[model samples]
Target chain A: MGAEFYHSVHLDVELCKGCINCIKRCPTQAIRVQHGKAKIIKEYCIDCGECIRICPHHAKSATYDSIDILKKYEYTVALPAPSLYAQFNNLDDIDIVLSALKSFGFDDTYEVSAAAEMVSEMSRNYIKKHREDAPFISTACPTVVRLIRVRFPNLLDHLLPFAAPVELAAQIAVKNAMEKSGLPREKIGIIFISPCPAKVTACKDPIGNTYSEVDGVIAIKDIYPLLLPHMKSVASDPEKCSVSGRIGVGWGNSGGESAGLLTDNYLAADGIENVIRVLEDLEDQKFGDLEFIELGACNGGCVGGVLCVENPYVAQSKLKKLCKYLPISRNHLGDEVPQGALFETEIEYEPVYKIGKNLAESLALMARIDELCKKFPGLDCGSCGAPTCRALAEDIARGFAREGDCIPLLKESILSLSETISPNQ
Target chain B: MEKNIKLSYIVSPNDFLSAGAVSEDVKAHLEEMEIDSEIIRKATLAIYESELNMIIHANGGIIDIEITPDSLNVEAADNGPGIPDIEQAMEPGFTTLKPNSDMKAKGIGKGRGLSNIRKCTDFFDIETELGCGTTIRFGIDLK
Candidate 1:
């Protein structure tokens, strides 16, 4: 809402090779490699950060709070993603990481998942109360939310209304800090130490919201070394840490939500493609009576996030070990939750790519889409941004795109030197 | 009243990879044809189950598809042991083929194949002879 154009993902012009790899990979067909570089259609991008992970050049990047920006506030609160433990190869004690975050210049460290416990309890009750007619989608992952916004708009009603662990943690921390010490909201900057760019974008333009509560984002990688020394200082004391129960902290991976809620009909799937397929099943009314579905953008879930230090393989074990016998989830009964704070209420949704202004116009647009497909055919090789050439034609038909949106044609035009060749000479 | 034009595909048996090919093709074509999303979804689901039937029990078959202004007709005919009892087959959990095509010694097994077809396509029809073959026809109206 800040700019109505705030982006968490961007293509670094210098790093991009104008390759259509991301164009092909984007499920929503939100990208178009027009001119020389790839451009993301702001309206179409759900900010899954699939490009950031897939790009070989490291060209696609998620924006994070600058190191210099830390100076703006009187104090910085570093709320590390639970995925951070997975980033380390042999890290055992959560305290070590907690101490290290202190070294990185933070007044205190908040385990974001601590608040997720409250969310877990609340979501469980919410699902139970609305069991019969609810198709509540998990709200833990921003990329998944974005995917719903751009691709599965029809199922938005199914998305459970809860602040993600990160948002919840931020709100709790802000509230606790204000109560404990009379600090102004502006004076305390709640910066999320994120494992993936999606979180950065989430904090920037949270889906289901007019504005994000997260003020800034810090990449775990940027602060990993800065906090390592503090881990040495606090090698013994476990009391100073925010060690959340395994069931709550276990929320990082696929199926974890169900594992926590303990619902028989729940489903959890990771990876953008897998999530989309599951969403399709949900849209088809497959899990009509199901209680919940957990979807993660990365393959093994957050452990698989691109920015983490450890491979998803190892994080799997670390997270498992950390949460082996998580305590019976504490009932935090809703804390008089503010009326306007929910992500579901904050974010607004309209169809991702409207076919037309009105029903008749939409019919006309469909006719146009048919014409375009007749011209382009349906091999969705992503040579065009619309997934299939057929989809591109439909966009053209709907007046959302044009023939010039195709990069191949532009490439051929340049090679043929159609504009520069001097026939008169 | 409906008028339709369709592109048919012949599915090959035991080709685990190409099991869902026909449905995939129909889905792509519907997009190209600019069919309504709801209509495309219903037709695709119906055709997918029909196509999978040819793969699972029919040892492969030809899917004759007809697309029209008002409806879509998909007829999957195969050269395999015809259904011994249409009533039992129609009932959910009565899979003549393996359970799910995936978990079976073959492919795609959740026993949801026929039930899925019933759940998807409207105007379902079936024709078969004991040792000869089977023919199934279904239509989806574009309302």
Candidate 2:
């Protein structure tokens, strides 16, 4: 739970009935059933929080920073993911949100989306360089990237190596504060107001060869109720605007990344399974002249994060209207801040993912998978306690769910348990 | 000694919805074994494509999968119209499926069923008569 790793998705012991719901739906086969409850396989888990988001029993939950951490920073910047703007209802202006943020002890609020604009432009340029492809694969969604690492190791080379827009935003915010105030880096802590658990996990365990640039991640859902009390309506006057309105916020929804980056021959893919399909096309070199590809592991992208506060569809609309009028984030924040600043420069790092030929290991895993397959009929009926057919397969592989975790087998076990009881007591 | 799970199901023709049922079950079994994704994908595609072909063209068939520790062996036999041209059908995109029928939910665009099954495994054998029937045997090395 410390800096070793940040896992936002967890099984709430009290709520979980030891069902395999999360186990079945995990895209990477990261979950397994143990003692009748679903558990996370840390090494395999990318922390996408699919279990947290899909659990109807509310057994799955995410971990984030404690509100106590706020006291550590002398000056705080509320760097909200663009998706945050999409959660509220009856919000007329940005000032209310800004003021509300101040009430929560933030000295100033910076838009993560502002840096996202530069990301948009950067992505466009990167895609232009690789336009002769089906999909270039969006680097913005960390969950989607992790999914690729586990499932499609062959396509790792196709991913853009740049840090995500949120990383860029955090880097810029920290550097700007460092240069402007000359404050010690420790005194000024940057807390990412994330809409998704994947971002939180990414901040904790970065991928593709670099230490994470983010200090801490706070899911927006945790702070929404606190901010709602101080919220007020802001006039639509452009003079009061401090950054790109929703340019960065637009990144919360599916297809929003592609929309944010104005480029031709671009394909936006949402949901882990769908992204896998598109990646296959990319592997085949079928989609030529493809300038860019945006992939989000969740159905509605960041808006659908397990830790987010509201309905994904509803949040998506809010983000759309919020950024509809604001200038792109690049022009807004980058222009306001002076050029030649340290924040504008990019930092280099090594990718965290490992690439090698482990045919022996893979074969062993496959053999185990075959053994697991022998247990269930692969109905994907959510009866064996796992959510999908593939997930049940993974559960067996991880030694979480037993081969006899199948429903009929479970029933037989229960009946046997009952039969073994003495009638006379 | 573990009892050999000898189970067989007839894959009737025109039953597209249920085409992958047995294969899906087999996949679940494989997953339970903690098999690697590559092996599972190979087994899945090979069985799934064969099942799809059985429903669309063969009118129906039977599949027998033998689960063993060393390896998994699959025998899928179809009774409808046999593949008249095995060599041509092995070519990618050689299916007799209607253009619209080619589309699947997963969006796989490969044209060669036999080729795909072959590519998905280390060994593949097909025996078919023009009017009698077709039987395919494939093995995935467990290592």
Candidate 3:
């Protein structure tokens, strides 16, 4: 209703087989197979990339900046996600990856993991000061933040009000680039190498914050092959580019954020379903004594992103091995939260799942949906283009669909109609 | 005047796995109807606590929810053994659940179910007979 919500996940119509795979796998039930093609209900989409991971036809793809985007600015600084370090095999030094990024045509590189360390320090202080709020939910994962914005409004206040690591890195990258190159803000490109599509959406349409510092986002998979050759050249004499240490690089895996907090009284859950369950229980005030809740939309955290090349578990182990030799943390914020660290804008509840406009109308429509639910089979087979019988009923009540769309119901009605028109033999 | 929407669910006894299904469903429904978040939160907690009580103590029960424009009324009727002392049962940390009971093992049945239900809802009522059954009624104002 308000311009269709921006989503990084897209359906390549030419490749789509209209299979029910993505429709069933969507955590938010946003996908519907209509007209023999999967349609994402934009408002309901959190850009979790579950569809991209589940689509058999490979039709579901994420939208991101191409290699040509590097040419747009006078000076471009690549902000590599922590997950990027986990992509390489036997990647002993993080400088190898950073140097490779620079050799691959980037004017400079800033490790997002470095900024993650700063964020971790800030989060520790925030949690200590806001003990009354106790279990503050991490706002690093854009998909998790977006999911909370829509579905779990009750826990909105519990969200950590800080910019994500990549965003903080972008802000710092842009500032440093501007001072060094004597260039205007528009001339400097602070591009992020992202592990997931949700970051692309975060850059385009940010939540919690008013504006995103990152100019463009390129999927890790896209940049993975191009950087491999550069990695070999820079492996022997890599630049002094690594600023982050263990705590920062550890952000690549699940439980890493909580581990960074250095608090045993925290709960960390990964995978979208698990995150949802945590949020649901949190809303019920289940975890009373937890100091923080770290929720990642991806299974093994950023390393498990849909755009990553390596296996998530393998990547996690690689990340652990890489961090073993690094320092505890390289970045530190003594007493004050840095400027641009906190969210400038408040995240509001979207209530996208509401059935009707007002209370009276919603009640009526809900009643209608219940009545329709009684008529339709409860198999949730997804043949009617909707995920479940209840979803179809909601669609029908909203006038987007009809009961006739249900194949099984149509068959029954047709059989009864024929019997009424022509007496039984 | 809008007609009240009535929803019902049956809580199975000692089914710790599916204990919170009804409350979750009811919460989702209320969210779809665009109910006030605070009211939904209160209603969900109350319903969840009552549902757990039915599973842990009352063998099983039928939970009926009546949703109107201004309020939500819930009635959890159980045919299992009823509460012997309503006054003592109303106190927090007075749970009859043994430490090894399935619910207790799952970190629930903390004796706060009844108190929590009463604390969260606008109105709370309990009717019980030692051998016959028990019914806990609660309501929350939606406005």
Top lDDT prediction, candidate number: 3
- lDDT score at residue A367, model 3, on the 0-100 scale: 86
lDDT-better candidate, 2 vs 3:
3
Per-residue lDDT of A1-425 in model 1, one digit per residue for the tens? 42364567888999888877888888677787756678888877766778887788888987777766778878767787877766665666676787777666777778876777777877777888887757688888888887776555557778888867888778777877677567888898788888787788777766666566677888877776666666766666643566577766677766777787867777788988889888876765545466788888888888787777677878878887766655655336466754333665544444546554544454455555555666553556666555677667766765667887766665777767855786544
Error of 1 at B127 (Å): 6.6
Better of 1 and 3 by DockQ: 3
Task: After superposing candidate 2 on the true structure, give the runs of residues whose Cα lies further than 4 Å from its correct spot.
Answer: A1-6, A11-39, A50-60, A92-96, A99-104, A233-241, A245-247, A263-293, A328-425, B1-10, B18-49, B63-75, B83-111, B114-126, B136-143
| Model 2 lDDT at residue A278 | 83
lDDT by residue (B1-143, candidate 1, tens digit) is 12235566878985766765777666655544434567767777777777777776778888898666556678888987988888888887766544444547543555677776867777888899988899988887755
Residue runs of model 1 more than 4 Å from their true location after superposition: A1-6, A133-136, A234-239, A263-266, A281-291, A322-331, A334-350, A353-425, B1-5, B13-17, B24-41, B64-138
Ranking by DockQ: 3, 2, 1
User: What lDDT does model 3 reach?
Assistant: 0.90
Query: Highest TM-score: which candidate?
Result: 3
Pitting candidate 1 against candidate 2, the one with the higher DockQ is 2
**Native interface contact recovery, all models:** 0.00, 0.00, 0.76
DockQ of each: 0.11, 0.12, 0.69
What shift in Å separates residue A297 of candidate 2 from its native position after superposition?
4.0
The order of the candidates by TM-score, greatest first, is 3, 1, 2
- Model 3, position B6, has a per-residue lDDT of 95
lDDT of each: 0.72, 0.68, 0.90
